[model samples]
Target: MNGYDSALFENRTVVVTGAGRGIGAAVVVAFLGCGAKVVAHAGRDLSHTEGDLLSRVPQGARSRLTLLTEDLSQPEGGADLARQILDRTDRVDVLVNNAGTMGGRIAAGTETREDYDHILDLNIRSVVALTGALLPALKAVDGASIVNTVSISGRSGGSAGSALYSGAKAFVSAWTKTLAKELAPDGIRVNAVSPGTIMTDFHRRYSSKEKLDATAAAIPLKRLGTADDCAPAYLFLAANALSGYMTGQILEVNGGQLMP
Candidate 1:
């Protein structure tokens, strides 16, 4: 919705990883509203998140959403996801690399090598592996797009124990630009969206209410962003009509939290 071209993705098959909740759910619903068949991925068994997502989808568009399950943290996860996509459709119009997690904030003294590997594997390695595996399917479709979900923490160093997550996203942001240039010749445009202070389970789980309110107060917009506010940015990047000429770009969806 968001008043953009609702049918911009008509008949297209868009694959969105991490669609079980938050930004991923918002993006899936947006694509469905716009008339695209969406392949939504979740890390675990279908749960309340999927149920909640279904309720938000229009009845007629309900059938457009197909669920795919895979733990992107595992070494074989990306290939597993891509195999399912290829099984469903030969051509993939869009691929949203949104499957990532901000791990438990480990204090400096308590951190271990496993912590670093977990975040890097989920946030950066999975993206690279999935995209590489699906390259053939993406090539089958003209004007295909790869939209990555990066965080504002990636642009500026993260606060407190968020260094690993921030560093991983920074890799993704940099890789997005590199992929955009490398894939441009094949008509595949790669881009990223940097979201800030979005009110979602991400915050509910990791940030206390007082901390969130403090973040809201510091934002120039005087409020935290909602999933709806950031969803349109992903839609714009995925639809050719909106951002065909734009590539290797990172669109910040923050409410003036950071200038970059």
Candidate 2:
């Protein structure tokens, strides 16, 4: 479980959004374990962090973690969060844009303008604002990396009632590549981790038990994924030692669900 070098990220600064639970929490813990000072955005409040992130992080590592809460669904939410981060640190060595949600299942014809706005605002706009605001901080360091969280649905189009969610993730998948190329000269590597059927609060809210079971049965591993299952991939893509030459790639962590 602890295969990574203990000091892989020593003295580095990593910013992880949506880090209060599930995959984001796992990624934060992994980076801290590797000796990185992590600035974690714990969603809209600290409640989720109390329930998930706080419990998983070790007491010693907690000193290195700076927890913040922000509602990234608002228009200026990402920029506001960036302001808070820049006020604390002058340079960011790694940026993990993991904040986003489906908002909810909206049926095709029943969707409203508000529904589209919520999905796109949180999934797309916030990411853009945050990444844009942090570009200077990232550029201050050498070999800075940005690891985005995408979805398998971006490639498969997802199940019923998830069209908007699927499309938003697809946008991120494409943006990851675009930013990788655009920022290559600045020494910033951009990549994404697309997960599938992770048994997180996300699925508990949107997916049914029967659907999850069926998804597990069809996968080559014959099991659904866990937050821990996907954490290492983010670590790999962020560390220059591991992925210095790798950028603009979407690392799929779906248990062989989608090979494309």
Candidate 3:
């Protein structure tokens, strides 16, 4: 939706985490296309960007984009990323807390302490740390927006081996609302986009084709979602011009799955 409104985000600064691929990449592209200066945290390395994000970016947009590789799953990962962004700019118009993963399907009974710690650290702690660290920058601008990437699993409980991941997402969902209340007076809107069964590397790594196909069949639309499908909701929530009165809400892009 680069053409959605080329000037919607003109002169704005957007920061997106886990933007090297999938939904994050699409969001980055959308913001860049709308003329926003973007700081993209491209996961732990640049390898993922080669034939994906890097190729899709317009040549002109490159001049306005900054890519950083950081392992947000680590203890200090979020703080590190915030420091990098702060070094470059003092204001952030939009902050997309989209860096997270299920890691892998570690069965509930078989999960170890390390597994639990890592999952919580990656999905929960990192977001809190990053957002807290960047509060100053976020508040520096008028009507700043924070769009988090939650999951439908957070509501449905997800499939096997995703208990922790689902719970973590639920935590973020609640946190979003709380932050919204706390930040509203500061003119910062906090919201989220919860994607369901998106056709991205996230599923490629964690789900089998048989399972994904079965899910698609169950959806009212009878199709799996794509990264592009979920990206626009984020833009809508982030752009004050599009959703100025919207905050502390979760937009589900699941093609009619779990209407509640």
Report clashes for each candidate as comma-separated counts. 1, 0, 0
Worst 10 residues of 1 by lDDT: 43-52
Model 1 over residues 36-151: C-alpha lDDT tens digits? 99988865556845464776887788788888788888777888888887888787899999988898887777878889878888898888999999998898888999999999
Q: For model 3, where is the 10-residue window of minimal lDDT?
A: 1-10
lDDT head-to-head 1 vs 2, winner: 2
TM-score of 3: 0.98
- RMSD to the true structure for each prediction, in A, is 1.3, 1.0, 0.9
Please provide, for model 2 over 1-260, each residue's C-alpha lDDT reduced to its tens digit, 9 standing for 90 to 100.
25678799999999999999989999998999999999999899988887788888879888899999899888899899999999888879999999888888888899898898889889999999999999999998988999999999999999999999899999999999999999999999999999988999999999989989999999999999999999999999999998999999999999999999
Clashes of 2: 0
Q: lDDT of candidate 2?
A: 0.93
CA RMSD (A), model 1: 1.3
Instruction: For candidate 2, report its TM-score.
Output: 0.98
lDDT of 2 at 17: 97
Candidate 1 lDDT (Cα, 0 to 1): 0.87
Candidate lDDT scores, in order, read 0.87, 0.93, 0.92
Flag regions of model 2 displaced more than 4 Å. none
